[model samples]
Target: MKQGLEPAARFAADLAAVWPEDERSGSLGLAVSGGPDSLALLLLAHAAMPGRIAVASIDHGLRPEAAGEVALVERVSGERGIPFTPITVKVAPGNVQARAREARYAALAQWARAQGLGAVATAHHADDQAETLLMRLNRGSGLAGLAGVRSRSTIEDSETILLRPLLGWRRVELAEVVAAAGITPAYDPSNANADFDRVRIRQALAEADWLDPVQLAASAANLAEGWQALSWYAELDWHEMVMRDPDAHGGLGFTYCANVPRVIAIETLLRIIGELGGHATRGEAARAWERLWAGENASLGGVLAVPSVERVEKVGVAMRVWRFRPEPPRSAGH
Candidate 1:
């Protein structure tokens, strides 16, 4: 009994760090896909909170085995006396994994809202984080991409908060936990498919025995904190140095004050791209700023960037200014 209590107590501590006790008073939703990681999460959640949790098995309908997997989760949750919800979602076209993920969260958000649950928890673990970091690094992703998965955040644009208390747990540890409970986890065929980038990365990480996934996950978490701090400062810069342009093209203008740091400018320009319904990579934003600073015009993600110097009578000086607006539609002949 003491041995069982120890793991539960530790899991509870991890949960409290992300989802406070006061926040867990209401029912918490658990995403259980019948995989070993999520099954361990289910067992841990049941052990920690007992009656205050519900289980959700999302069936993407991509494979026939998904139904059996959902049924397994339902049976396990029923054995523990926890409420279970089986949600079937339609995966949108294009990028099967990405669309499936989007649909999964959307369904979970809708279910949680209707159920009035306090928060939803998933089973993203440390190994998953390391894989994500490596994948992003391979693609030359910037800070935001390398930050990996956040422990706690809102689901998409919804108010329902999502939690990942198992970020500190390792894949083998989770598999052991489930095995010790005498439960067989359903294996997803896609996990073994080498066509997926994550599967390939996981295989590579397995071969490199010297690399530590826990340390890599810790680095990703540290990067996440640094990104958040930079973002806060960027907001201040945005408010101080950025203004909405009155041009009919619906543009944004930034005053390139003498003291503006390159980091702040890059972050703020990324914000401008998001606000204008365009997506700009961090490298693209930095290059745009560099060109504008050199008195050259640049275009990025369907937005035109032009730099100029403007005289202001109130300030009694000329200030460097960068204007960003939607690029005009090109003529058909051209």
Candidate 2:
């Protein structure tokens, strides 16, 4: 009993580090899918905050076995006297994994709201973070993508808080917790499917002797810290060097005649594009910023960026200003 309680104690400490005690006194919704990691999360959460925690199992309805998985989680929650909610969500067509993730979060957010839960916690362990970093690195992802999954963030289109307190925990460690509890975790066949990028990456990581998932996960955390600093700097730059161009015909403009760090400029442009109701990936935003910095025109995500020659009264010369606006609609084919 002491040995089993050790992991739960560690989990409580880790969770407390991220979620303050005052705030954690409220209800926390656990997203348990009956997997080893999430089942471990359920056990740990129940032990850590017995009365304050509830369990939720999302059934994406992709596989018939999902019902069994949800039932397993519900049963475990019942045994612990934790409130359990089984949410069934429909994943839209296209990109099975991605769409399922979207559906999962959407359902969780709605459920959290309905339950009046202060936060929703998911079991995203260190190995998962390492896999995410490698996958993004393979695609030459920027700082944000390479930062991997954040420990805490807000759900999209919702005010509910999402937490991943197990980011520092290893997959094997979570599996051990479940094993010790004498629980048989539900098997998800998709975990072994090679068609999925994460499955392939996980297999490669298993075979690669030189790679350490713990170290990789640490690197990703470090990157996340660096990205946070850059984001703060970008906000500062936005306030100082950015303004709405009166002549831009309802758009934004960035004004800087002096030298600015390439990285900071890209982040600033990302902010501007986002504010203007346009979307651009980090790579796309970087390329667009580079073109605009070269005194050229560029377009990204329905937003057009054009350099304008304007007279600066203080400088007494024609300085180039970058103007961003929605791209004009094209006429019939010429």
Candidate 3:
């Protein structure tokens, strides 16, 4: 019942609506980076759910200041009697931002598993969602991509779920929460760097008079609903119109009737490819569908689709079937 803890309580209620009450009964992992947003989350989560939270800060080792930031978060967590763990991750040699993100989540997931925590929460706010939407739109993303960052997602291949409870709050609101808590948060210099696409988009959105973060986030939520509806129907179609090809020898595969809708066909193919240890991008799936419709064989991303005829017993009819299979691996020299 602290004076500045109202926002945290409000967010706690918001999280409760999404998460089961039993799930929140256990200790939750909070990803605190000591930035204004994460720091605010640390304070708010502490106020809302006392004695049920542990904190961790990831040091990507990209900058010298990262260690100090982790130290700051550790101190804050210690002062509140919360368990604190600091993790250092080595970034791989590609796409610094993306690699760092992957490493960060991996480390967090590992730490959370060790601690027996159920879910890890981050401080992605409305502005972050807006920036993500704008970036995906600029890249010509489809409906699923345009849905932007989800509020809850499984961390890669890990069972640990990621929760973003602050997506409904704005950046400025988080700053206000930090100020009200009388805590000084560390700032990362790279947030203002124009070399990063997200930073540039954030700057542009700041200068625009008509654009609002809340509205942009709402649009993303609407698109997420649309994406969900598509997925629902896709799964329905998968169950109704597709079946496993039991006679396949090389790898597991599926077959669908030629009369299936294009969207359903593409979704079913993508699901099959995913199940067979391969991935097909949206464009690849669409092109494969076009090839199947034209009665041509197509192969991409280690999956192959070809047209075949199946004889129906007792019906005396040869029905067209689109057979999908995983491609055989190439030799080293090839």
Model 3, which residues run further than 4 Å from truth? Answer: 1-5, 248-251, 258-261, 308-320, 328-334
Global lDDT of model 3: 0.85
TM-score of each candidate structure, all chains considered together: 0.90, 0.91, 0.90
Error of 2 at 205 (Å): 1.7
Residues 88-163 of candidate 1 have per-residue lDDT tens digits of 9999999999999999999999999989999999999999999999999999887888899999889997999999
Question: Ranking by TM-score, best first?
Answer: 2, 3, 1
Candidate 2 vs. true structure, TM-score: 0.91
Tens digits of lDDT, candidate 3, 1-110: 32355786787886776566776545889999999999988988899888989999999999999999999999999999999999999999999999999999999999
In lDDT terms, how accurate is model 1?
A: 0.87
What lDDT tens digits, residue by residue, belong to model 2 across residues 72-187? 99999998899999999999999888899999999999999898899999999889999999999999888889999988889999998999999888899999889999999998
Candidate 2: which stretches are off by over 4 Å?
Answer: 1-5, 248-259, 308-320
- Model 1 vs. true fold: TM: 0.90
What is the lDDT ranking, best to worst?
1, 2, 3
